[model samples]
Target: MTSGIHHFTGITADVQANVDFYAGFLGFRLVKQTGGYADAEQLHLIYGDGLGSPGSLLTFLVWEAAGRGRTGIGQVSELGLAVAPGSMGDWLTRALTVGIPHEGPSREFGEPVLRLKDPDGLIVKLVGAEMATPAPLNGAPTRLRGVTLLTDRASETAGFVSRFGYTNSGNTGMTQRMISDTDILDIREVSGFVPSVAGAGVPDHVAFRARDVDAVRSMRLSLEGHGPTEVHDRKYFLSLYVRDPVGILMEYATDGPGMTVDEAPGELGRTLFLPPHEADRAEDLRAMLPQFALPGEERFPVRELPFVHRFNRPKEPDGTTLVLLHGTGGNEADLMPIARRIAPRSSLLGVRGRATEEGTNRWFCRLDATTFDRADIRSEAEAFAAFVEGAVTGYGLSADRLVFLGYSNGANFLAAFIQLHPGLVRRATLLRGMQALENPPAADLSDTDVLVISGRNDPYARDGTELADALRARGARVDFRALLTGHELTGTDVTEASEWITRTLSLN
Candidate 1:
């Protein structure tokens, strides 16, 4: 049986900030970026030493927009990483240089420790001691040293961990120190403490290393009736999960076919890897995942603009830029997958709606179920126009090569923008959209090409046709197509939009 910790899994609400701190600031090499085991929508990031050894891994599940979690009983309250002995001062200096607030070179467990919190507020203790793993890269911490598990039943938890070769080494106050070959287990007894909440920044589970598949199975058999044990094939490793007596989640994972199983060591974290089951929805998954830039990389900086947006530069550019607008309750990243499918080589710009209704996002305020607030529409349109102008200037994009794609509420806003500010957008695609303006001014759009795709059974189909009519009256060449669907988009939408974009680009 393999001893010591395999890895610790935690939660992070902001993927970009988390990556910046762990991979950029802390200098931990990002070994893998993949979807979470339970849910493919949330990202799972693995950071470790160069080779991504079993005992050196720290993983996080990206839970965007989740609230902060409470750290108390039945939770891993702190993560400890090992640095070379006598390196506490240098680590503290680095933290200060990076503008990260940290506390103390205080002595803990007879070792110097510098304490800090991750972006999501997870406590991290950088201990002064060399770990039994690979050498540190970029002066990053060597490896995982220990984890502090707060629980009311510390003795029971200690007994449980002892099954996996953790022997009680010593104690300090209310904490019992258990030692395995490569990791330490600090079980701190918090009597009558509240159990931890499941949210961002809280440790989800702690995994122990298993020698192989047979070892994992043997461990599962040893704990045949312990709470619940379910084995899962995690592609890189076979694992079994169970709950300890104190309700803390625990796992035994195989260490072979490790982090480099799918990706080369040099290209480990550059690409996002999905499970075999989700291979079919690869493009959609890639688009849905949050876009982030590595630190020191020349990328679009998130600025304080009129509209919140995300930009994705393709690995290979075709000199075309597509600006995307999402529907009601949708965000900037919502339409990225569709945009990528339509124009794979084009740069994608996804802009979020500014207005909100009952907590959900909208391009403009609606007066009622079927009526929109015209004043709000006009104000937002002007702001959106300003954003487009600024984005073109800031991103150094060619105005004539910008193609607009909008859906539903976003499409309605785009329709208003075209009418109110003609000659700005050269090409546009409206998906399940309608006219937002009750009475529109006449403007010449002779230089424009538009595609209006509405669902045949959509409630807004009649209004969408009127929008197409409005565009055509303005002298804009329009390709109107109705698909057999409802309000939601379909694969046929991608097909029609792609074909229309190709035709327009050819003409350009």
Candidate 2:
């Protein structure tokens, strides 16, 4: 039967540095050096035990020039490697000798754990376990012990994973530990930390073992009752990906057609390998990809703040532009259609929220459903304001004609950003958004035009009025409406928003 983690895949900035850390320092074998199956331009490298075992494999999709990612909510915060009991001393000595920055020889759930950060700031924990495989490197880590999933909704995530056969083992402080027959999982509820961003040094997805193709198919059917599930043929395995209640990306993958299927055992990772599907376009893909070579002991400079965004120029270019921001869990492309429907001729700039909860994107971290982290809100707002400034200048668009259109969390972030940089946006449409700042910023926004649309029956209905009053108090012209619907945007909401945009633009 499918057992524990088949592999944990993450993004890396420099493939050479990654090789140096995992293969050179830690002494894990490079099982397969290949190109990305889906995106052939990126490098896909795998590190594992002597044979590239399922539970031992750590995989990375390297984008050499990519910027450093922010670690936040809605992401796998830590990857735990299981080491033989009493081997913590040896591992600690190795880390110190190599100058690896680390913390904690602390004990959690009665297990000894040493935590450290990789070159790109991804957390790696060496966990002491009796059940781990015999280490190949000085009796240190043998296989992946488990993964730590950080989320806001811990109870919901715990319940969901339990439904899929994980049993609650125990809890250490705020972390809930779960055990499957073949693997261990930990869930930590984090509030107030910055939400995670996707880029280099972020664990993108975690895959569980499935017995075979039929087991993977069955798991997909079971997961549908909870949320969305997508099945893909990975060539080496058949897999299904799903997001839990709080947004952690979980994959159930079949165990057959192992890593050695394509290459010979002895020469597994010696040369570049491609999936069968991409074999035809290998030459073309190689031309586009950046050339790589083994590391020579020097570290590369880390680029900061990887922001995911999309800018679209209108076919019939209007002087005005719409900056679209989507709700929590929505991507940059999510609000493009809405922008087009409202302002067809206007250029569009859609920004993906950087903070993630589990796998869902959020503008900032929340203390709970109602309370927000004001500090994080302020930090992200500053970053977003800079991003907007760059976009306006780069796209050759007038800052005066740019209108901000945001929904829910996106709208809340806009509320915070506008308060700090009031003149940056002259007009904005906030849909079902609330005041994100704990203590509102004092700004003279006399000439600014704002429209806030909310559902009367929504839980955050009061936030709409609070935000409108706050804006009005600061001398801005605020138009507030509370429709007869719930939290969702209805046809009436869109119609009203379109009218408001027209009236506001015409006046300007």
Candidate 3:
């Protein structure tokens, strides 16, 4: 069940036009054409390379005139295509040359991508998937990897992906990873559409790759679980559908090798690699096929970090940033999931704590493991504060409009850091706060959206009147809430926090 996305299907406006764009313009193929399998209410069209293997495959519902849907903070924003490595630069140039305006050549989740707007204004991305291999999963050498998009309801979408045999890799992004051979999928969470975008573009709808009926049933089994597997027999292929937490539609595609399996791996994009079952219509498809752009140069660049921070560039005109810090034992990867929470425009940069406590990320000394060492805390607080100042200034991220979020030890450090140096965080959320550092770190918290979320009864980062008074007195606009749980963050915890941040970030 830990397989990457077999495929995800979506409803679209134009059937032939959709096929033209994804196939002719983007170099995918029509793997299938038929009545909707799970829902006879519509038609389904499949496209991708090499039978839409692992990182390929896209399907649409051909809902040509469906009114625009509202995509919000917890919505799936875009779907990414893994293009030739080191080809973004070339593709950007080519796209511009061909009048296909592109926005990136920037880094996202530590990789390169070219962000563009499709005919429908849906966000489309072409990424330089630089990994050598994908994670293990149950499948046929993986025809589809994972569906990529943004979701306000992360766990919801994750649950949906789980149905298609996708397992979490613990890495997140606006476009995150599920597993197969290498990263099979890339899903992102887009807060909203880009300004001036005209139509529904990239993720007209997500589609997964599948092996055949057995694979389809396997995926259905994964999705249905203890109950009966949801199955539908369409004219073209058997399928199943479901709505994940965030409300995005997902589909389990079938085998028959589709278009990708039609041609040799090296010839996937050279010609129309249709499924063998459709050989009789090859000439007809070719005549109707649109010309396509070959894989191009990689435009984005990724550099290693010498210090504690990681910089993941966004593939958009507007910019948003997530300054990540790890708790004990949590390094750069700790706050990566949090970074994924900031979709569409935001990028992630993670910072590791300076000192180690019991081999964990500790900013200062510990007082018998649960208390604080006042002086050590103060020194570490100042140290992190200075780091933030330098980072904001040095990294061109001036404290304005910036979000600083942390957890456990990392949360303690961030709380201390912000208090000591007000204005470093425009809006901040502390997963589990610490009250031991009652020093009132700074005196300039005006203009900051202070969030202190806690488990109902947690010891560390425990909330009491002291925390509320301290943050409020420091001029922080605080939303301190204690949830039903203790110390640990449930998906519910993250869900609430995401909700709060969404509201806080949208204030006039």
Instruction: Find the number of clashing residue pairs for candidate 3.
Output: 66
Error of 1 at 411 (Å): 2.1
Count the clashes in each prediction. 0, 6, 66
Model 1: per-residue Cα lDDT at residue 180: 91
Candidate 1 worst ten-residue window by lDDT: 295-304
Residues 403-485 of candidate 2 have per-residue lDDT tens digits of 99999989989988889888888999999988877778789999889999988888755458998988899988999998988
Score residue 505 of candidate 1 by CA lDDT.
84
State each model's CA lDDT, in order. Answer: 0.87, 0.79, 0.57
Check candidate 1 and list the clashing pairs. Answer: none
lDDT-superior candidate, 1 or 2: 1
Off by over 4 Å in 3: 1-306, 313-318, 342-345
- Ranked candidates (lDDT, high to low): 1, 2, 3
Q: Which candidate is the best by lDDT?
A: 1
Which ranges of candidate 2 are over 4 A from the true structure? 134-140, 290-508
Q: lDDT at 2 for candidate 3?
A: 28
lDDT of 1 by residue, 1-508 (tens): 5798999999998788898999888889888889776787678999998989888899999876567999888888899998888888888888888788788989878989899989999989999887767646868888889999998988899999999899998999999999998779999999988889989989998999999999988888898777679999987789999988988998899998898888888888888898888888877778777667677776566555788777777778888999999999998888988899989999888898989999888999988988899999989989988998888888789876799999998899998999888987999999999888988888999999999999888976544678899999989999999888999898899999999898898886
RMSD of each: 3.4, 13.6, 19.8
Rank candidates by TM-score, best first. Answer: 1, 2, 3
